[model samples]
Target: MAPIINGRLLFNQLPNGLPVPGKTTVYDASETIDLETAPLNGGILVKILVLSADIYIISRMRDSSVEGRSSPFLLNQPIDNYGVGLVLRSEHSSFKQGDHIYGMLPFQQYIVMPPATAERFTVLSNDAGIPWSAYVGVCGMPGQTAHHGWREFSKAKVGETVFVTSGAGPVGATVIQMAKAEGLKVIASAGSDEKVAFIKSLGADVAFNYKTEDTREILAREGPIDVYWDGVGGEALEAAIDAASVGARFIECGMISVFTGEPYHVKISFNIVTKELKISGFIVTSLHQAHLSHFYETFPKLVKEGKIKYKEDVTQGLERAGHAIVDVITGRNKGKSVILVGEE
Candidate 1:
């Protein structure tokens, strides 16, 4: 059943000892959305079409107030992330009725969003000409992360050997593609042999199963990688550190391997003091301005030319969001996991 407009409130809770649960209520939105106070000028009402469930969301369950970074997933609020939606109502100057857009939206049935919210929501262009889910993957956060992190942080050179963990994931896949495009020799690692094959298909020079082959053994053969794109941290990070080249650059993106439970501690074989390597952790939110500009400036063109490809593991309905999120977090689903919120 479709949610009753302005009469429903969805809340997500991750209590101390309980598993995460999403609760829905037929409540008034007048209190939550401030409907009476919402600006009448150029606002949009969107029904989500597809939503992304990334592993980083787990960190939001940690200490809420840390380093002045407030998490979006509060104790009892509905979680929100990048989602593609269809415009149901438009009172805004920029958007017309029935426009398709992608942006940060709550995990619910409907969102009456303001025009400012639409600023981040791009009108899906035809040049890319792919599935709407691509907006949540390559043309979205993951792809942008790979481009920006490599260009700005790593400054990866042409001949550099770039190592990427979780290479079968949307972000890591793009990292491998971009690295290969830049003429960098790419080495990738994943959890399974199947993922290793997929990584190799994406042009990774060498792909390994971290579960069986041992990352250390693989790195020993391809020692001295110049840039380590640390997407799956913990023990993988430890291994990458040992294999890094002198003055290597490590861009810490996601730590999926250690996102849940107690963090893993792996003693490094190399002396950072002697190796002179640099490791920097980056949150996509911090580089918002740059990412937004890059999204508009580059993505459409790449898509038009068929230069960029995105893969999505789509689940059919909104009711399945929780399972999809779990699948994404646990790496059970290959590629990006999205909840298909609307029919074509």
Candidate 2:
């Protein structure tokens, strides 16, 4: 039972725009624990291996008074999200040492899940030889967001056009691949030329750098987009609406562009009446019971077989987690942003 360093990132303050590492988060790695003797008290002690940093995390770092999609990050506490870890010691009957699990984990080098709380975690079996990082990206929450959104909301038919914003991101990348597999023409957008190139490599028929180009102009030229897989909202949504075909489907996953209180004046317009478009947003957790079984069974196989290639933006160490959050929110991350806390 030797002493082990326990490093964690705590939410320090809410940001007006993109958050700064030291200012927005307090990196506290001064704590130490004895892995063998630390009291679990009928719980499980885990060594966190991979920590997910998604754009949705920014949505949670607001004032507690303002109700939001997820719970607000409590100031001076660890930011909780999806993570993969290995059980080092367990007093719980269902869990034991050597088991790898994934759940809504705190951003720390180690964690102790109380008996009741440990019930929420799912033990994983990675026989497919997929990277542990994929569990936080293609095989975890972001993957579920895409898997469920496509099956549940997207009503795109074969030969139709499917448009995706943030096409280089985890959810958007998955949707683009899914649409391509289903015999649809894909038009996708990303904030940078590099991302647009990456999206095009994923079989998108048309990929554009949205920062320099006009969404309305491109959609007007190449659209009548049958299914709009939306990650960037505000003006992007307005453009999608303008380019949508009759009875088009809008799978609203994220609103990264407007989350930081940015001013956006784009009206939704009158197309909702004339076109009969179906715009739907979902929290992936809500759709889990209906779809998780199938998603876990099939999606991992697709990822392992290279049918769904995941683009990962991995930042090493718990120390850099705050900057990782910035990368995701500011669209600097090339794909699914993640903080690699440790090796599997």
Candidate number with greatest TM-score: 2
lDDT of 1 by residue, 1-344 (tens): 33354322244454352235353211224433443344446788776778887776665555465543536466455567788888776887778877888778877667778777777777876465667787888877787787778767887888999889989898899888888998999989988787888888888899988888878888889867999999878888988888888899999998876755567987865556678989888877677776667665787678667776656788876666766776777777877787776664
Off by over 4 Å in 2: none
Provide the overall lDDT of each model, using Cα atoms, as 2-decimal numbers: 0.74, 0.90
Q: Give Cα distance to truth, residue 39, candidate 1, Å.
A: 10
Best by lDDT: 2
Q: Give the Cα error of residue 175 in candidate 1, in Å.
A: 0.3
Q: Ten-residue segment with the worst summed lDDT in candidate 1?
A: 23-32
Q: Give the TM-score of candidate 1.
A: 0.86
Model 2 is weakest, by summed lDDT over 10 consecutive residues, at 257-266
CA lDDT of 22 in candidate 2?
92
**lDDT tens string, model 2, 196-260?**
98998999999999889988999999988889998988898998998999999999998887875
What TM value does model 2 have? 0.97
